[model samples]
Target: MSRPHRPGSGIRSAWWCEFSTRTPAFGDGDERVLLRAQSAETPTQVMVWIRLAVRVLLSGFDPRDTERAYHWLDHGQWEAVARLADGEPYAFTAAAGRTHVEWSARPVLFLPLAHTATGPLGRCAEPALCACTARGHRCGGHRR
Candidate 1:
């Protein structure tokens, strides 16, 4: 089973995406961070999460570039959108709220869980006992 998303104290993920392609050979690399919040106390909204995810995945370009984004989840795989050469951020947001030509691109957040991994809470997805998850206590098991 997967770890239950705790919300307030969620996981943080960061990755570098080479967004700009002005040089082709040396793209403008940027860092995209997503503080995955599973708890109700999370401050970031779903759209913000999606936007940040999109921003990281679709880094680079301006908010006025004309390149269109082409992404779709087909057959369990998230296909990559067409490279937005000088693409803009608004394009993706605008791509939503409308059904265009063949590609009816919309921002419907679909968070599919991956296979479970070893968690801090021994035998459980919860954090280990004590303050190990934060204060650095040598916790054992999922509870104190």
Candidate 2:
């Protein structure tokens, strides 16, 4: 079930859409807590969180964000990220018959989630592509 709309709730919704890839991973209790926290956050705070999560994912240091993202992102969305990471050309250095992988730093790009018939909080069959344009409707994009 979708939550009731409140002032600034769109920001929270948009954050979920962008960060979670529109997959609702949270349980009812977790959703309540996260929504409350997100509702209290400013736009700048949300952006900072997104940046930190992306940085953590790219660095491959912490698995927490990755785990969360796996739960939050649908299969196609996760596969897209995996493909991007896998396609990255990394250098390998060999020393003493041992090979070490060195990953090159790549710029992370934030792409907006495509709108679906179920909206941001709903389950979509095709999570990677936008249905709004295909349905001949204009999407307002993300809410400010």
Candidate 3:
């Protein structure tokens, strides 16, 4: 088995995010099933807009529509980032806790910024799985 990546720096920790597909099993076996998220706790409209604006400013206009942006994130960027960070590899799904994470990307997939723990993690420092950099190795910072 592989060891979980520990965040080494605050910025790295803040950048990497994760979600699991396993949900608490409920009801009888026949009726029970892993529940997927229905909606996001808070939508990613603002973040998406900011990212899009930055992209446009840096590059140029993208011909894709809004949904495309969401898909690109849900299936593309988010997955790549998680994989780099060694996050549990699983599709976007919610648990019975009723914690719904929609869009499965960016602001939606990312844990709320407030949950971050301050200070260094000592020897168990969280590893950074930076996508903007090279392979999924510790670059710096922590988030979980």
Q: For each candidate, what TM-score against the reference? A: 0.19, 0.19, 0.20
State which candidate, 1 or 2, has the greater lDDT: 2
Residue by residue across 63-100, what tens digits does model 2's lDDT show?
55445444443332344334334533221111111212
How many residue pairs clash in all the candidates, one count each? 3, 0, 13
Candidate 2 Cα errors over 4 Å, as ranges: 1-18, 21-37, 60-144
lDDT of 2 at 119: 63
| Model 3 RMSD vs true structure | 17.2
Comparing 2 and 3 on lDDT, the stronger one: 3
Candidate 3: TM-score?
0.20
CA error at residue 112 for candidate 3, angstroms: 18
Best by lDDT: 3
Candidate 1 residues lying further than 4 Å off, grouped into runs, are: 1-44, 60-123, 126-144
